[model samples]
Target: MSPSAVVNKRAVVVEPETTGHKNVKTKSVLLHRHIHYEPSTVVAAKGNYVELNSGQKILDATGGAAVSCLGHGNQRVKEAINRQLDQVAYCASLFFGSSAGEALAKELVDGTNGQMARAYIVCSGSEAMEATMKLARQYFLECAPAQPERVNFIARKESYHGTTLGGLSMSGHVGRRALFEPMLLGNVSRVSACNAYRGMKEGESTKEYVARLAQELDDEFVRLGPQTVCAFVAEPVVGAALGCVPAVPGYFQAMKAVCDKYGALLVFDEVMSGMGRSGTLHAWEQEGVVPDIETIGKGLGGGYAAVAGLLIGHRVIHVLDKGTGAFSHGHTYQGHPVACAAALEVQRIVREEGLVENARRMGEVLEKQLKERLSSHPNVGDIRGRGLFWGIELVRDKATKEPFDPKDGIAMALHEKGLEPKHSISLYPGTGTVDGKSGDHIMLAPAYNTTEADITLIVDRTTAAIEDFFAQRSYH
Candidate 1:
């Protein structure tokens, strides 16, 4: 048998043969993202830990790409899901809508303080982003002037939007875009991301860095012919592509200024950073720049259901309302009732429990503990984040900020080491932190309601995992 077959065979666990005939367990036919090896079978999860079929309980620190904001198996969300299922599980959003979808959209719009006038629910971040792109294009067409020339988009480099083709076209993540480059649209262009650790020049003030980035964006708009640009897209806090890199202070404001100058919409893709992941309902709230169009997911459903939504600012809404009174794009599961209900309950729990504030408080403790435990380590080049989100960049030379060669797979190695029974932790790892081909970092995005003790455990296990990983290998 092949290596994958061997892994599949090992994954099977035969129950005790109580009957007269012998019983055998069947191998998993599920095609997981990772093809080379079978992933650990998670049998159960609760709070901050997930138990594998092997009975090894792993502490979930990253919340499965920062999706489980309220943690696993939330009773309230489960109940809400069942309630919606009993009432209306699914509906053709194009023809009919459910109370669950209406309530969720109203809550989302109100959460934005009316800045976002409408919410278009969808299945995932990719779908949300795809809708955002199409809406942007349609908005231009629907405008009084009918600027069909607006066909280009300006996005930041080293950012992740989503996985679909349109989302990929807007994303600047190199690895995710490499194989799909030929198939991606040509109208999308990229500017330097506001990554201070690596992008900020030595001796450069924060104001200067922000101004330079803003100018780069302005230049891109001018190069693309301002009239040809529909929007400038970015993540208020950069996610997986750069492993949770937050923008420098005044960064989003400056970017927004450039977009406004050219009459282009500002689109914030907050799939990973929104929905209280960064201690705020929307990441842009802290930046003081509300996006003209926004996409939110991941924590929006808190992993209870597959859901995301597009928040349309008044500017875009007015154009579409006045011109066509209809959005041209639609998905079959656009307003999934079960998903909306689950997300609504998750938001309710987050608000009632004051979990966002808790995330803010616990984030401080997590940062302090992480720095205290790992800052002095030679391989740890930088630790940065906001709220419950953070990343630790691994470097070969701390003094020079030299990233380990991509061939080393340092991030993946550390992630694997973290899963070892002794460490018993789950870490989110990312590569191409330096550019699109090099650099390594591990991310931590604990649940919004993570406590001080949980933070301590997380930091302890994380520190041990890092130390053990480095100890097993030598670099000169």
Candidate 2:
């Protein structure tokens, strides 16, 4: 098939026509996320590009949901994994502790400036959230006063935590929760997210808006009977749910105050925003607050392994250490040696190479380039983010900030268009940015080590993809 045909087909897998491989056209048995659209088969990935079987080398702008912080194929991480494998690939966390896990945990705790006392490593963001919920509940149970009645959790509307039942219960993403609402925990409730673009009223000062939000949170606690609340969960920088929206200055601080007043734990879900993706090592650092319980993932292993972790602050640690002296949770692969090794090395490289500083410097360039090139587009409603993480919200009417109909699939269409040979770029697309079901946004989270020239190429391709996507459609 020609490149044009491949582009027209939209995520169809292209079969090789070599004499030996001609008859290899077999239906895929592995259940893919999108059943109808067979994604292009990736042959190899290195640096910032993924080469597909169709001979297309696509630039990875979002790093596969912002996971690849170091980009792909880092020799240091590879060697670390190999070294861990040589010693032990997996160890039952309950029975034994591995050196890799110990080093990684120490690294994470140290990174937090000793503010966090312990680290519980897990396999994915969802698992980390699950562990976080269990740990928070346990902390309350083991507290000196033993507040077992503190069972409720409060999260923001239009936010995402994870896919697990506990995490999903805390999440406010409408589309993801629609089918599983019956199965979700009833104790969790939601308040408004800190979205200045939509939530801030006309002529409202940032201070006033923050005060209003804090009062809203305080009211929710009152409505739920503040004593019943266990935690107030939130992402320091909103990820896919709101399209990389950062909290307004002083927003998190106010929320933390409310949490403190109510004696509820403040849980920061940094699964997407942590690990230097947001310029700062921790997103909460910028907000001038430290969470009681924090989850870190995505960039932790830099796509070298499936890894995420929970960082426990001194308060939670003190309670747990004084009471049960044990966490009431365990996963079969809680601290997989290889994953820990990869993550430890990735963190080392991040610190040694000063990739965090690089992300901060490059983020400015990315932000400037994006605003200059695409901010004036008729369909571009808003551009917001920090560090290597950025998001572009698309709308039907820029004047009114009207999003396109959900059926239009505008964000995913832009994503697919970007993967076509002409564009050869990968963008992370998301819907439900405005509410939980009515907006479209594409996120860009390049690797931490991305160069200025890389930013130029990413912006060029991103601008072209957005332009070409809207150019082919009519609004009327």
lDDT, each prediction: 0.84, 0.87
Candidate 2, residues 1-476, lDDT tens digits: the string is 00000011233322111111112444778654434434567799999998888787989998887889999999999999999999999888889999999999999999999889999999899899889888888989998789999889999998889877888888888877776789999999999999999899999999999999999999999999999998999998888788889999999999999999989999999999998999999988898899999999999998899999999999999998899899999999999999999999999999999999999999999999999999999999999999999999999999989999877777767877887789988888777888887888888999999999999999999999989989999962
Worst 10 residues of 2 by lDDT: 1-10
RMSD of each: 6.1, 5.2
Clashes of each: 0, 0
Stretches of model 1 off by over 4 angstroms after superposition:
1-27
User: For residues 1-476, what per-residue lDDT tens digits would candidate 1 score against the true structure?
Assistant: 00000011223211100010112342547643433335667899999999988899989998987888989998889999998889988889778999999999998899888888999999889988888888999999989889999999999888888778988888887776776789999999999988899999899999999999999999999888999999999988787778778999999999989988989999998988888988788999899999999899888999899999999999999998898799988989888999999999998888899988898889899989999999999999999998999999999999999999777767766877888899989888787788876888888999999989999999999999999999888963
Cα lDDT, model 1, residue 436: 70
Model 1 lDDT, residue 218, Cα: 92
TM-score: which candidate is best?
2
